[model samples]
Target: MIRKTSLIAVGVVAALGISLWGGSAMAQGDSYTIKFGNVISAGDTQNQGYALFADLVKERSDGRIKVQVYPDSQLGGEREMIEATQFGDIEMTAPSVGVLANFDKSLEVFDFPFIFEDAETAYKVLDSELGDEMLAGLQNSGLIALGWGENGFRNLAMVKGTVKTPDEMKGIKLRTMQVPMHIAYWRSIGAAPTPMPFPEVFTSLQQGVVDGVENPYELLYSAKFTEPAHYLTETRHIYDPEVILISKDFFEGLSAEDQKIIQGAADEMVAKIRSLKATISDEIRAKIVAAGGTVTDLTDAERQQWIDSAIPFYKENASKVDTEKLKAILEAAGNTTYLEAIQ
Candidate 1:
């Protein structure tokens, strides 16, 4: 009887071992790798912020997941990358919200010329109910908007001359991202807004295909947009948003735990990127000045001129965008000027 009991116990232990091994195999099989790609140059604030995301995911997953980052347009421009993510060919991409608005016009509200006056105001709106509602629009486009990142306030840099006032921008050729509102805004102000990829701007400026490009101080320094466009204008005319977008298909495929892990990491990285940008404006503008390029800050009156000039633009393009959505944003601004929403 003792021998028979011992044999039964051994059989139970053997079954348990097989079950545990099968469970391990199942867990391994369920793991999926994600590729995170961006157009930003490596080591810039965007990439530094993105690194924080990668580290968080690895720590959270304990190595069950991997996020591979491809920077510097090694894959393609923001538009191309977004398409890749949509089709699930690539897992993720973050484009400046300007290009992203093309995929989902609801985001064009962010494209509103001079919508955000400061990052704090932007943060309040972006982190609030308004931002969440806007982000939800991405699901239909096959994108999961992870979190907001920073592109900061955009300033104009020109190869031709320093623009100290609205009049100075007249007849000047400027390069803008491929966004309609931005192009229209510049056109209204009498500057030719050329649309192209971030990578191609340097060559376009070098070849004199375009006279100027506009971006925040950080991008101007990192992308070397200032070298080709020697005159820097702190126009800050358009306040744009940069966003981190993950493929909805891939994100939805992950377990709920993994989904939270991926999103939580991006949330944490936004503050870091914003903090880094906050401290760099003066220093970056100074660096450009030290290099013998002219850096001009618009006077308060000059700044208002840029703002007032957008009135005609809004009248024309606001209808061109979704009127219902525009009403929501306008209502958010208290039915005042679009500038009120950001300020």
Candidate 2:
């Protein structure tokens, strides 16, 4: 009778163990919702990549996680959305590195004019240890940096005339993103830099609030800025990168497995965004031309002139950002000339 009673007790314990294990597993699978927001249009390259990320996360998590992407500032403008993410009011956002620099000053290095000669160089630096360190800096500000997304190279689009060199931009009232580095650079070069929100740019250009605005060709074309500002120059001045951000609070609350799923999907999103970006400039330039806009490419000499003009701006502002990190980016891009000049 004692042996039989012991066996029955063992059976009850086994059943209890199984029940507890099942309950824990179910708890581990608790559902989560990520509200991903961006200022880009619904079908823009960035949004498309974000959509892929959302899909991948949901599929990988077996529907335990759902990501809802709100694009075109549906949630709010970039700055607003960034703050929302920081406070966990929203789950995610991707903002220009320049805009993000407002929250984490270290990112200002990317806003310097002509910091990168090409997209490949930008990618090399941003995917390196230095870039990761810079991204990690966001944690103090309550953001989780996923990966860098490209906004391509910002070029000039003028309403009246082509601006191929710094000399051409003198006294030209230009609209700029309200980034300090951007404003400082344009102001240093004698342009009347007008800081304004993105939504106001089109009308600002149309109503003569500004003579020209600078952005990637894709944005200029898509936003119909190329229509009002028909003179497009391939200055490729600044390589604007968007930073994928999440709320640190929200991210920490996630299960490790779900966090891995979200992060892995972000990595894939970066790759896909870049792959689509590889040819987007040329493609959009064609579209701009097809739409009755004149596009101009700088001669090697003109490009060099633009670079030289940036020296004063760099010398003045480089000291304001993290010198070591800036040096790393320059080294990564093989821009020894600039590194030497800045020092």
Candidate 3:
């Protein structure tokens, strides 16, 4: 009878242990390994922010979650990475809002040229209710949009000469991101816009396939595009914010605790990325000049001319997007002219 009782007690204890272990396993939900990808170099600000996110997730999750970052299109270009994330083939990507707009048409308003005066105004719009509403639309596209990251203001870098006035852009074969609004704006301004992937811009510039390219100073200097296209103009034509995205399906499968960690890290990343970008333009402009690229700035008059040139573009394309959201962004940016015109 003593032996029988002892065996029964052992079986009860074993069953209890198994139940506890299974509950714990279910709570953690099959340790997730996130594959994060981007098109920038490993040392770029975006990557720095992503690395921080990965570190925070690993430390906070007690090593249950592992994040691996693939920079410089190692996974693929922005569009491809986004698609991969949507299909659950990859885990995450930070794509320029322009690229993301192709998937969520509501985001297309962000691609409008000369819409934002500076990073501060851009941030105000993106951090407001309007931005959250736009981000919320991503659920339909299979992406869970995190907060916004910065691409900084895109400037013109040419192989031939500096472009100050809108007329100066005439007939220049400028390489543009494969975003329709961007292409349309350039075409309206009289430039022959050549749409291509980010990876192709540098070689196209070097080979004379495209006479010039436009991007943030950080990208131009980091990617060595300024080496081939020596004339850099501080056009500040567009304020592009990259949207940090993850697979909605994968995100939903995680425990609520893990979800909080991922979301918190993403918020931290936005702050880090914007802080870095806030001060990086001047630093990179100096680097470009030191590397023998000619850097030029527009006069106040020239800047106004650039702004005025976009009126026609805004008129034709503003109706293509959600006008109410566009108005909200304009109101947030204090773009009274465009806002009034649209209204």
Q: All models: lDDT?
A: 0.76, 0.83, 0.84
lDDT for model 3, on a 0 to 1 scale? Answer: 0.84
**1 versus 2: better TM-score goes to:** 2
* Candidate 2 backbone collisions, by pair: none
TM-score of each: 0.87, 0.91, 0.91
lDDT tens string, model 2, 67-156? Answer: 999987788788999999887688899999989999998888888888788888888888777777778778789787888888899989
lDDT per residue for candidate 3 within 219-314, as digits (tens), equals 888998999998988989899899988886666555556767888888898899998988899898888888888999999998899988998888
- Please give, for residues 257-311, the per-residue lDDT of candidate 1 as tens digits: 5656777788888877888888888888788878887887778988888878887
Query: Could you give the candidate ranking by lDDT, starting with the highest?
Result: 3, 2, 1
The TM-score of predicted model 3 comes to 0.91
Instruction: Report how far off residue 170 is in candidate 2 (Å).
Output: 1.2
Clashes of each: 0, 0, 0
